[model samples]
Target chain A: MKSHTYTLRVEFGDCDPAQIVWFPNFFRWVDAASRHFFVQCGLPDWKTTERERGILGTPLADTQAKFLRPASYGDVLQIESHVSEWRRRSFVMKHQIRRADVVLVEITEVRVFARRKGDGSDPHAIESVAVPEDWRAMCE
Target chain B: MKSHTYTLRVEFGDCDPAQIVWFPNFFRWVDAASRHFFVQCGLPDWKTTERERGILGTPLADTQAKFLRPASYGDVLQIESHVSEWRRRSFVMKHQIRRADVVLVEITEVRVFARRKGDGSDPHAIESVAVPEDWRAMCE
Candidate 1:
């Protein structure tokens, strides 16, 4: 199982009036970590893929997250992410947000390889594509 | 059931390289919508509640969100939020994110009214408080 770790510093703007890191900020960091994992696994930029293969990017189909502990601004957090499962057209990515040895949040996301609909159809329409074997090999 | 709506304009920084509003930004808006619901229902700010009753803001325990459509910068989105269920120590909030009549995302969150542990214990420790009758009445 290959894993990538993304580190971030919680800034003042990331916290709410309660002085704790706002929950949505955690999602932002996790989303960034998801992309970083792919980059580290040798995947090209999404722009390149969209231009070459019409593969826009991985778009999340479903996501569930649990907050186990609260973090405050100025804290340093690390997100450890890895692909936990791979299906025909979708995959699950798991992320554990931790401060030192204490786990703060956990997230699991199901995402698909998306491509814009062609054939003179709706410009905003997108559909899922099968998992590319070469991308999977590179990730693994 | 009483519901409150909050509207916001998507800003440039809220979008990603794809020129679409990033997924996490929707969570941010929904979080703000959750707070706005309480405010619209005539509840005081978290600061007031914390000072008077030792009740911090509601903290999310779990959340599930589905992205039905993508949004972009400059788009105006509205979120309709309301309390769908109330339990002893937790409650569920449902948020519908829309651009006019088109729903862009749906989110359901389980959150708890939290208070700091006062047992001369760890400062960061927090525990859920039973749903306050007065507060529930205000929301309803």
Candidate 2:
């Protein structure tokens, strides 16, 4: 229900010729912040999991992002994400992108389906399954 | 069956602490390439629609990326995207991540739904909607 926020600086590639953050790159910042949250909560990032167990998973389903202000290259930004809702079917995570403490973008990503263990044909239907106990134990 | 590719130099922020390209960043790169495709087709990126016309929509389905190699900072990479399938109800986009001629990732995005504008209560459904004439008319 609350958030974990992290800070990162916008690099040159994160911006465009206009010297502002490229629109699509917002997802990168959100994903990086989300990864930080997962690691902090004990879920290994994809790379770590692949190295240790040869398994990986990522968000599937839907997403929406709204840009409120322009972020320039070299700006120090803060990203925050929290479990906004948890249902038997799925969970919702909300993220906010800000520059120098000013809000820049608001995002909500709904991750429902996940595939693991290098399987392409079969997807683990998380909606029909219960949240892993570890998820509840960490961000609670 | 053809692709429109975009070239960009990798930056540290695009990688993980291990100095390899992060998974989510691959999605960002493909999206940037998609915008490039739109430009080539004579359409403005969606941000222009959102900011200039208030006609905003976003993908509401799933996107998946398969990572084949590590991409590091200072490496100039190319992302290729093309319409692999355009059916009556939905479409599919295929993406390739490459460094010079070496392929690094292959991705496909299937959009099941879309959030559209000008509806009274909720966003409009997007099943079977036609790709705009100008956009589709571009290679004609």
Candidate 3:
């Protein structure tokens, strides 16, 4: 599968009081990278997808990450992301965050295409849908 | 081990375009819950620990999380956290985020007590330290 790279610069606010990139901020960047991968693959934005197909967005089902090294503000980082596997209702995305040649973190996420549940029980509820063939083809 | 619960109200800014809580924000809340667990165990703040014992903070080595449900702004959530296991130089924390009686997310984190590496190779480098016996005692 083709991979997409999303580059970002660490900001002071991204770091915690310990002067290291707060772990949660890494997730934020990875989330952006996930979306960037879809965009680079010629997929429409979530809003457009929702309007066309009722797919609101891809929401994470599960995620695992290993933090190998700490990153601080002023560092330029690149996140290389790709869809590693496509399941019936979910897919796995693999992401490697690197500062130059050093890999700082690696993450694997299982995400599903979700749409709002219109059953009127809970307005905020969402349900996952099967992987769309067209979307998977574009990503591949 | 004793467990601690941290409560917070989800804000509008924490949600993404889907009007659900952005996944990364869950990590942020879990991180806070981790620290709050330590504080509830009578451990000093990171600054004090660093000043007195050269322990900067517990930095995550690895983490895994499962997102069970989506939450939106105006929801009041509680994260219950506790150390599930302690290794020689690392420990595992388990967190469950809930809205009322509904569990929204579950996370497991392997973290280490880290200190700045003063050997002068990389200023931002950090090294893990063995779990402090006194601190572990306090937590237990």
Grade the docking of candidate 3: medium
Listed in order, each prediction's TM-score against the native is 0.92, 0.51, 0.97
How would you encode candidate 1's per-residue C-alpha lDDT over B1-140 as one tens digit per residue? Answer: 99999999988898776667878888888888998999998989898998998887999999999988887777899999999999999999999999999998999999999888866244357888999999999888
Docking class of 2: incorrect
Report clash pairs, candidate 1: none
Top lDDT model: 3
Interface RMSD of each: 1.7, 9.8, 1.1
| Candidate 1 per-residue C-alpha lDDT over A7-122 given as tens digits, one digit per residue, 9 for 90 to 100 | 99988888876677888888889889999999999999899998898887898888999999988877899999999999999999999999999999999999999887765244
List model 3 lDDT by residue over A44-93, tens digit each: 99989988988988999999999999999899999999999999999999
Off by over 4 Å in 2: A44-55, A112-129, B1-140
The candidate scoring highest on TM-score is: 3
True contacts kept of 3: 0.82
lDDT value, residue A39 of candidate 3: 93
Chain B TM-score against the true chain B, candidate 2:
0.76
lDDT of 3 by residue, B1-140 (tens): 69999999999999988889999999999999999999999999999998998888999999999999999999999999999998999999999999999999999999999988875355378899999999999998
- Docking band of candidate 1: medium
Q: How does model 1 score by TM-score?
A: 0.92
By descending DockQ, how would the candidates be arranged?
3, 1, 2
